[model samples]
Target: MASTPRSVWHNPVHFLAFGLGSGAAPRAPGTFGTVAAVVIYLLLPVSNPLLYSAILLLSFAVGVWLCGKTARDIGVHDHGGIVWDEFVGYWLTMLMAPPGWFWIVVGFLLFRFFDIIKPWPIRWLDRHVHGGLGIMIDDVLAGLFALVCLQLLAAVI
Candidate 1:
């Protein structure tokens, strides 16, 4: 069971932190949030790497605040329902990725893998860090790892 906060619907901050309500899912909220992120990524104009990078920068900054504030409000360090990190993580994985559904699916799978596995530094940060930045950093690193794998795969194929 997940803590689906009532504030998620009524509060904008909570809503965003909840990955626009996708994080409210009873199970695998992070996966659902990542799915929502794929939709959002498709809607954005990311053909330009610079623009995409800018979007990543801005979203990451705002996510730190949004996630931190929501955690404070909900009194949870990183609630299962708070999945803004997933949204940004998926976007980061897709940065500079070759444009195609195959690539998108690959990126999605890779991001999910790294996010779930949380190898080494990612796991360490998740355990040691606190608040919004803590919540966001692990996912960011996962995305970066996925990005590297995806890019390498793209190069090989």
Candidate 2:
């Protein structure tokens, strides 16, 4: 495991890319980062889909750059400590979700499940892609997969 350096916390880009330091957790940093993302999503006033989408897009754009930069600096591709992708991906998963703690928890589980499993094209993308885009796209697809599952559950329930 690549440890996060103290210098990474001091760098603005590294700070954000690491999901506000949640990614620096000794164990399951990606999971911690996703939890942090959930907290941020709940705090924000995101009833408007357009606004929510805009924020997700902007975050993803910046995440690609910052995540890539941090990975390069650390000399690793998609290091476990670089989890801005988790933040944006979780936000995307909750994009059209119903407003409730229940849904939020469900979304979190689903996103984590898909992200960890990296089924099909998600795994393919993760292996074949490179750089910042590579780091962001897999999580984005995982979020989309979770979104679909969440939507299906919502309809059924």
Pick the TM-score winner.
Answer: 1
Please give each candidate's TM-score.
0.98, 0.97
Q: Candidate 2, 21: how far from true, in Å? A: 0.3
Per-residue C-alpha lDDT of model 2 across residues 1-157, encoded as one tens digit per residue: 6888675679988888889999999999999999999999987657989988999999999999999998888788998988899998899999979989999999999999999999999999999999999999999999999999999999999
Q: What is the lDDT of residue 50 in candidate 2?
A: 92
Global fold similarity of model 2 (TM-score): 0.97
Q: Which stretches of candidate 2 lie over 4 Å from their true place?
A: none
Q: How many backbone clashes does candidate 1 have?
A: 0
lDDT, candidate 1, 67-107, per-residue tens = 99999998888998889999999999999899889999999
The TM-score that candidate 1 achieves is 0.98
Indicate the worst ten consecutive residues by lDDT in candidate 1.
1-10
